[model samples]
Target: MKKYFLIIVIFVVISLLGFSIIPKNPFYNINWSIMSALIIGLAMLAFFWNFEKQGVSSKEVALIATMTTLAAVSRVPFAIIMSFQPMTFIVMITGYVFGVQTGFMVGALAALVSNFFLGQGPWTPWQMFCWGMAGVISALLGNKKKEFAFTKFIILAACWGFIHGWTMNLWHWVSFVFPLTLKTFLATYIASFPFDTLHSLGNVIFSLLFGKTFYTILQRFKNKIIVVPLDNNADIV
Candidate 1:
């Protein structure tokens, strides 16, 4: 745990330092995105090393890798198919079942891979952080199974969407505006309202429709993973 804390601290500090040092929109081409993925993957590899010390199951690792990879690939299809976003739902469901640690990895890795195809930019790290956190948040929420209700899922998805929109807006906030004024921040957040809405709606609908099943499938790979019946058993919890 302490190692995780130190790692997070380093990542945050590096993120801020890189933000100030790297030119605006550093992720403009395919090469840079691939480079970024390589770099981020290295960092993730190290982070996972710590967690694996406690005996990381091969099933969990394989599941995260496969699911996240598929999630990454799905981004382009989502763009071509329904025009919906790629991965917030997938990662969140990942977090819900497999645990937050798994979700974070899934979200971050998915972002890393998607960046390769979508092209990279200064927003790469932030995008990685946002999607990764979706998984983490799912894990955090999932830990408290007592409150796992359908309505709560909507609220959580919307909340994650809002945060993601605002975080993405922060990139613009830094590039376009300076001094981080309240007016600028608030305006940016407000401007993201539409995307935020879709983000949340996507989460709600996806989670309501498939989160449990997806999560159920996700957990099946875990050692002794529990499978819950889909029938309405609100009182079960």
Candidate 2:
């Protein structure tokens, strides 16, 4: 509950800051990028704190780091492809196997880390938020069961491709597009349609080909982490 509330607060704060609600603030005028990064970083820290409160073990922390690295590195090989990468799918699978908090962390970290190579700007936080939501949504849909229906997740991945694009579009629109009218909004989205479609297709392809394998592998590790050994000296009741 606290985590979900914090997520909402993060979104609201970012949205407000982006729109310049504080009017003519000198610090915001000087360096909005740093400000945005700082806010998003703190938000990530809040989630990390939640993980600590839940008593996340060293093994789980290592697993999360491993998955985050995988998701980030996977973007490099496909950098030339416009809006087509397996990172989103990988993040979703991680979230699906691990749970919401872990998923969000992986997704957010992937965007942040990958941007080191891809180049970061004001867009970094938006990417983090969008990808993080992808993980959260996937975890919500598939984390409860030991087995998941692939078709459902495939469809979800496809849809999230557009959702991710549209959310980013909203950032672009709000930040750059003038007048904030319906026509400009539609124009912005229309211009991005092709790239968004490719992203959607890429997600579908990845999900179809590798979703189950990734899920199974991660789930196996997750199960191992959950296991507890009995004391040999203890007698049976």
Candidate 3:
């Protein structure tokens, strides 16, 4: 547990330092997009390294890849919908079923991969972080329950929409918004309210429609991957 907490602290420290240094550094000619990507990539690597130390099975890696692909692909069709997408629901469900580590990987990878079609920018890292947090939040909320709580997840997903948008808005505010103040902060969030609402509504809808199905499917796969040991001295057929 201390190791996990340390990993989280490292991620936070690196992110804060990187973001703070990027805009102010005049000595190096670094592209904001590239620099930001590098920062987020390193932070994500810390988490992945921590996860790797846990001795992941090949089946677990494959499962994570499959879910990441699914989540990424799901976003493509909704690219034109202005913040409305099923990807979050998919990532959240993955996290709820698997655990936080898997959830974060799926969410972060989905953002990185899907941007191939959607266009990558400085926003890419922010998207990765936000979506990754979505997975973490879902896992925490589920609390290792064997059964999916549909109503609870639906509400959480709805709230995550706004949460996600507000978080992304912080990047915009800090990176671009001039004269950062209370008024500007409020304005930024206010301007994003409608889009955030759309995101939230989309999450609620997806959760209502597919949350249970996805949960059951993941749970089944999880059970199949468990390696049960045979009793010692058991007779062979």
Candidate 4:
């Protein structure tokens, strides 16, 4: 519990400080946001490796892959709308149902795989980070609860939408704009508000309409696929 809280705090602090420092630092010639994003993404990958590598079953891996694929494909329909994507909805639900590691993998893989079609660039890592964080955070928030409520899910999704947009805006500010400032950040956020709102609303609507159904399906699948080996002594002779 404390470990998770510490990780979240460290990540948020690093991200905020990185955005503030990267633009002015003379040592960083290229886009600093990308560098920071890469570091953050790598750290998350490492965390997943260390924590889940030994215990994760084949069924869990398949489940993560399937969720990632669904999240990636779900972006296609909303491509025309700019920021609206069902990816968030899928990710939130997956995280809520599964554990943190599964959520992180689904979110990160969804970003990586989807970019093949959406055109990968510096923004890819940032997208991966934001979506991945969204899942991780959602899972953490729901850790104590047995069943998550629809309203809470919608609220969380909406909050993540803004967070996602703000994190994404960091790249553009660092790469295109010079000398990052609060004014510039505000401007970027203001410009992006509508799209972010769309994202939030999309998440809310998707979760509201399909949340229960998806939860049922995934819960059933989880139950059906899980395998527990019997103790050697329990075997009938």
Query: Who wins the lDDT comparison?
Result: 3
Could you give candidate 1's per-residue lDDT for residues 156-215 as a string of tens digits?
886887788876776677666655689888888888788788777777777778766665
Clashing pairs in 2: none
Sorted on lDDT, best first, the list reads: 3, 2, 4, 1
Candidate 4 lDDT, 193-237, residue by residue in tens: 998898888888888889989988877886798665677546654
CA lDDT, candidate 1, residue 216: 57
- Candidate 1 ranges beyond 4 A from true positions: 1-49, 52-54, 80-83, 144-148, 223-237
TM-score of each: 0.71, 0.81, 0.83, 0.82
* Model 1 TM-score, all chains together: 0.71
What's the TM for model 2?
A: 0.81
Best-to-worst ranking by TM-score:
3, 4, 2, 1
Query: How much is 215 displaced in model 2, in angstroms?
Result: 1.5
Report the C-alpha lDDT of model 3 over 14-91, residue by residue, as the tens digit.
665666656656524444445555656666667767787887889989999999999999999999997899999999
Location of the lowest summed lDDT over 10 successive residues in candidate 2: 27-36
